[model samples]
Target: MPQQVRGVIARSKGAPVEIATVNIPDPGPGEVVVDIAACGVCHTDLTYRDGGINDEFPFLLGHEASGIVESVGEGVTSVAVGDFVVLNWRAVCGQCRACKRGRPQYCFDTHNAAQKMTLEDGTELTPALGIGAFADKTLVHAGQCTKVDPSADPAVVGLLGCGVMAGLGAAVNTGNVSRGDTVAVIGCGGVGDAAIMGARLAGAVKIIAIDRDDKKLEWAKDLGATHTINGGQVDAVEAVQELTGGFGADVVIDAVGRPETWKQAFYARDLAGTVVLVGVPTPDMTLEMPLIDFFSRGGSLKSSWYGDCLPERDFPMLVDLYQQGRLPLEKFVTERIKIDEVEAAFHRMHAGEVLRSVVVL
Candidate 1:
């Protein structure tokens, strides 16, 4: 029998998301049904609601989710019912060319459940990032469920499902911050703060955080920034270089994807230093940096997709670290809300009042 659960849905573009009763089908082959414990209200969810991602109308909005495995469909073996898991958007398809080259982090073919969840009246619903989870339960591809330490608080651990992982991976995986390295992160949003934490964890000697908001800069300090540069008050690149012994940071991460911020990161990196772009940019955006500057910058210009994460190999280890207090995951959860509060949470986000407003089921 199908089950009806309360979920938030964006009925159409630019429309406010509303709580509704959604029908969840039985898991299909290689799929799983998750009893979601908590789901974070991320920017992507708001983007989906605004139709910024696509015209996938009536989108089921919630992706940064953690839950307990309620059941698995045929051929599912990586996890079992009752397993505690963090849901990931990218369910790596092993046969993709990237996987064949052993770079599964860039796996071209990711997956989602074949069957669709629906509104109570039978309208097909598109799950946000293929893992709509701002509900009591959700359906996803079996591979999307990454098992983690059950001892860790699910509310905090679930955040790693998206923004946190993307930011941390932006620094450690794509930016490749190392011991004694100088790092700079542009934007003090959740992702930027995570990059600062990653730099700290990697033993960076100086971590400069640049943002326009003073509250966010304070949040960045708590996360591990050695220094803060208010972009609104000064030239971000100049301040960053001044903090790093008059030389720019070895790795500069642009957490704000606008072309202007990208230029800031590009110029604020030392010669041969890497620039990691984890920020999502709009299609209207374009860059006009000189060809000579591109040639002069001798290091990698990389984009981190889902933080170059391999869920099976990473989520569990991070959860264990969180359980041991090595990672301050709890600090990221600014408030716990119900599924119905997603719209209000978006308001809070727009006002820049909180780090994360998570929906606790």
Candidate 2:
């Protein structure tokens, strides 16, 4: 039987989200129903509400979530009913070309529920990132569920589902931040701070944080940034170079996803240093720079999609690290909110007032 639950939804573009009746159908073959414990308010959710992602209106607007599996469809052996799990957008299809090449992290085909959840009126809703979770229950492919230590805070570990994972993966996976390496992260939002945490976890010697907000910079310090640069007050590239002993950081990550921030990341790295782009940019954004500089830089420039992470592998490991006191994942949850508070959380996020506001179900 389908269940009717309260959920946040963007009924139309550029409109505020509302708590409405969402119908969650029972899991079909290869699907599972999750009873969400906590769902984090992400910038991506706001983007979807603003129509930045697509014309998919009436979007069920949260994806970074942690939940308990309430039911599993036939043949679903990966996760069982009553398991605590984090929902991941990227449910790799093992037969895809990327997965066949042993790089499931870059799997070209991902999985979502084959069946649709609907409004009270039976209108189909589009799930954000294919895992709409700002509700009491959500339906997703069984592969989208990643089991983690149930002891961890749901509000905190749920972040590993999206932005936090992207930032951490940008440093540890894409940038390959290592012991004694100097790392610089541009943007001190949740993602940028996660990069700082990732660098620290990877044993980076010096971590420089760049952002316009002093509050975020302070938060960066708590996350292990060795230095902070106010991009609004100084030439961030120059400050980073000076802080890194006249060269620059070994790895510079752009978490703002703008051309200006990208250029700063490009110039803020030492010669032959890596630059990782993890921030999402709008479709109209374009980058232009000297082609010669690309050759002279002599290092990799990479874009991270979901931090190039494999949920099955990275989610459990990260949750364990968070539970052991090695990773401060809880700090990402700046506040806990009710489902109806998602719009206010979006405003807080836009005002640079909170790293994350999670809805506790």
Candidate 3:
């Protein structure tokens, strides 16, 4: 039987999302139904609402989420009903080349629910990041649910599903930040601050945070930044160089994703240093720079996709760290909001007022 539940959806491009009746079909052979406990309001959801992601109108918004397995399809064995889990977009297919090479994190053929979730009128909805979790319940491939400690707050651990994971992975995984490394993160939003935390966890001795917003910079400091640079008042690249003994940082991460910020990240790194791009850029955005610069400055320039994370391995470990008070995951949840207040949360996010506004169901 199909269940009807209230969900937030963007019915058309560039329009406000609304609560609508959504239909969730029973899990198929490899699917499970999750009863959402909380979902974070991410910038990507707003992008979907604004038609920035694609022409996938009627998108079911919200992706960063934590929930419980309410039911499972016949073939499901990894999780049982009532298991606390963090929802992830990546459901690696073991047969894919990436998975076969033991790099399931880069799996090319991720899985989603075989059945389509529809609106009350039977119109199919495009789930955000393949895990539309802004509702009472959502259908997902069984592999999408990564079990974590049930004691942790859903609002906090849920963040590991997306932005938080992206930022942390950007520094730890992509940038290969290590002990005694000097790291600079450009952008002090949730993602940037998460990168700071990751760098700290990786034993970075000097962590410099750069941002235009003073408030977000303060937040970055709380998350373990050794110094903060006001990018609006100072040249970010020069500031980073000055802070790192006039040599720049070993790892520079651009969380802003704009070409200007990316260039700043490139120029703000020591010679042969790594630069990680974790911020997402719009499709129409373009960059033009001297080809020689890329050759002369020899180091890794990597784009971190979902923090290059494997949710199965990372989520549980992060949750354990959070439980032990080693990771300040709770700090990311700036506010708890109802699902209906998501639109306002988007405005707050755009205004740089909150780190994250989570919808607590």
Candidate 4:
């Protein structure tokens, strides 16, 4: 029998999400049911509500989550029932071309639960990022369940499921930040702060954080940034250059994703330096820059998907780090609220009042 649980859903475009009864069916083959303990409020959820991701209405709008595997279906061998895990959107199908080529992080085909969770009237809902988790329970592919240290706080470690992982992966995996390198991150939201922490973990000598909000900038400093720049008050590129001895930084990450911020990252990196774009942009947005600049940049310009992370490899390590006090995961959780407060959390996120307003079940 399907279980009926309360879930937050975007029933229509640009409409506020509401708590409704979601019917989660028993797991099918290769799937597992998770009893979510905590789910973080991410900007993507807000985007889903605004019709930014797609026209897919009635989206199950949460993904950054931590939970325990309640049960497993046939052929699910990787994780068993009762395992503490973090849910990830990308469940790489090992046979995909990218996976076969040893770059599973770029897997073209990812998996979700074969079964659909529905409304009482049987309206099938699209899971946001393929792991709709803003509820008491969620169903996902076995591969989406990445086990982590159960001793860690669910509310803190759950953040590694999305925004935090993306930022860290952008700096470590994509940008290849190295020890003693000078780094700068533009935008100090959850993602940006994670990038700062990643750069610090990679042994960066100087990590400059750029953001328009002083509150966010202060938060960035606590996350390992060596310098902070208020972009709204000063020229971002110039500040980054001056801080990096006029040669610019070795790696400049754009966590804001807008074309303007991307441009700042472009001009803020030293020659032969890398630029990693971790921010998500809308389809209608376009980039316009001098063709000559692209050629003269003399380095790689890359966009990261889910921070180019292989959850199985990164999640446990991050959780362990958090447990050891090397990574301050708790700093990301600004507040904890019930499932029904997701809409209010979204508003607070938009107003830049919180790094993350997590839903604690």
Candidate 5:
């Protein structure tokens, strides 16, 4: 029988989300039903609410979530009922061209729960990142539930499901920061701060965080940034060059995803350095640069989609890192909120007041 679960839903674009009854069906083949424990409020959720991502109104918002498997559909073997798990948006299909080429992280054909979760009035709901999780229960493909250390705080560990993963992977996976390397992350928001932590985890000798806000730059320090540059106070490129002993950082990541910041990252990177763009940009945003610079940069300029992460591999490893105290994932959680507080959380996030406000179910 389908269960009526309490969830936050956006009834229309630009409308505040509301707590509504949603029907989650028993897992169909290859799917599983998760009883959500906690979900983090991310900017992506706010984007969906503001119609930044698409016209998909009535979106079931919130994707950074941790939960327990209550039921598994046939052929689901990745997890068992009762497994504590983090919900992931990318459920890679092994048969995709990317996966077939031994790059499952780039799998083109990811999937979600086979059945549509619906509103009380039977309206189909578009889930944020295909893993709507601001609810008591949600459904996802079997591959989406990555088992983790149950002892870890659900509010914190769940973050590995999205923004945190994107940030961490942007450093460890895309930028390929190594020990003794100088790394700079522009934009000290949650994603950029996570990049700072990831560089530290990867043993970066010099980690520079750049932002306009002093408060965010200070927060970046708490997250392991070795240096913070107020872009509003100084030219980011000049500060980066000076901080790196006249040479720019070995890797510079643009977490703001704007042309100006991207250009700063491009110029602030040392020759043969890597630049990873993990920050999301709007569709109207266009980047213009000298074609010669692209050729002259001499190394990789990569855009990471979902941090090039394979949920099955990355999520569990991140949870273990959090459990082992190697990654201070818990610091990302600024507050715990009720489902109805999402709008307020969005405001707090916009105001740069919190790293994350999680909803505990």
Candidate 6:
């Protein structure tokens, strides 16, 4: 039987999201129903609400989430009922060229629940990142559910589903910050701080955090930053260069995703050092830099997609690290609120007042 549950939805562009009754059909083949335990109010959700993602009206928002499996459909064997899991947007298809080539992280084909969740009048809702979890229950492909230690707090571990994972992966996987490396991360929000933590975990000797906000810089310090730079006060590139013996850091990560910040990141790394872009940029944004700089610098410039992570392999391992008192995943959760307070949380996030406002279901 179909189930009716309350969910947050963006009805139109620039309109505030509202709680509405959503219909979830029973799982089809390779699908599963999950009882959402907690969901993070990510910036991507706000982007969906503003129609920045697409003109898909009535978007079912919320993707970074943790839940328990309630039921599984035919051929679903990855998880079973009662399993605690973190939801992920990427559900790699093993047959994709990327997967076949041993890089499933870049799988060209991913899976989502084939069934469409709808409004009372049967208007189909596009789930944010194909995992609408800001509700009592959400339907996702079985592969989207990555089982982890059940003892882990959902409010904390669930963050691995999105921004946190992205930041960590940006440093460890994309930036390849090895031991003794000097790393500089710009933008000390949730993602940026996670990158700082990742750099520290990867044995970076000096982690420099750059941001406009002092509070965020403090947060970065707690996450493992050895030095901080206020971009608004001083030239970020020069500051990073000065901190690393006038040569710049070995790896520079731009988490701000703006042309100016990216340009700063470009020049803030030593010659032949890496620059990793984990921040997302708007379509209208463009960069005008001298072509010769790229040729002369001669180093890797990569953009991290979902931190180039493999959820099944990364999530569980990261959870274990958190449980062992290594990763400060809990620090990322600044506050917890009811699902009804999502709209207000968006405002708090915009003001840079919170790292992450999780909705505890």
Instruction: Give per-model TM-scores.
Output: 0.99, 0.99, 0.99, 0.99, 0.98, 0.99
Give the C-alpha miss distance for residue 221 in model 1, angstroms: 0.3
Superposition error at 332 for model 1 (Å): 0.5
Model 3 Cα RMSD, 1 decimal: 0.8
Please list the residue runs of candidate 2 whose C-alpha ends up more than 4 Å from where it truly belongs after superposition. Answer: none
lDDT of 3 by residue, 1-361 (tens): 7799989999898778899999999999999999999999999999989988899788999999999999999899999999999999999999999899999889999999999999988999999999998999999999999999998999999999999999999999999999999999999998999999999999999999999899999999999999999999999998988888888899999999999999999999999999999999988889999999999989889999999999999999999999999999999999999989999999999999999999999
lDDT tens digits by residue: candidate 4, 240-330: 9999788999999999999999999999999989999999887778989889998987988999898999999999999999899998989
Report, for every candidate in turn, its global Cα lDDT versus the true structure: 0.92, 0.94, 0.95, 0.94, 0.92, 0.95
Which candidate number maximizes lDDT?
6
lDDT of 4: 0.94
lDDT of 2 at 199: 98
Cα RMSD for candidates in order = 0.8, 0.7, 0.8, 0.8, 0.9, 0.7
Per-residue CA lDDT of candidate 1, range 211-255, in tens? 999999999999999899999999999998888767788999999
lDDT comparing candidate 2 with the true structure: 0.94
* Residue 121's lDDT in candidate 6: 99
Worst 10-residue lDDT window for candidate 6 reads 49-58
Per-prediction tally of clashes: 0, 0, 0, 0, 0, 0
> lDDT value for candidate 6?
0.95
What's the distance in Å from true for residue 214, model 1? 0.5
Residue 246 CA displacement from its true place in model 6, Å? 0.9
lDDT of 2 by residue, 218-242 (tens): 9999999999999999999999999
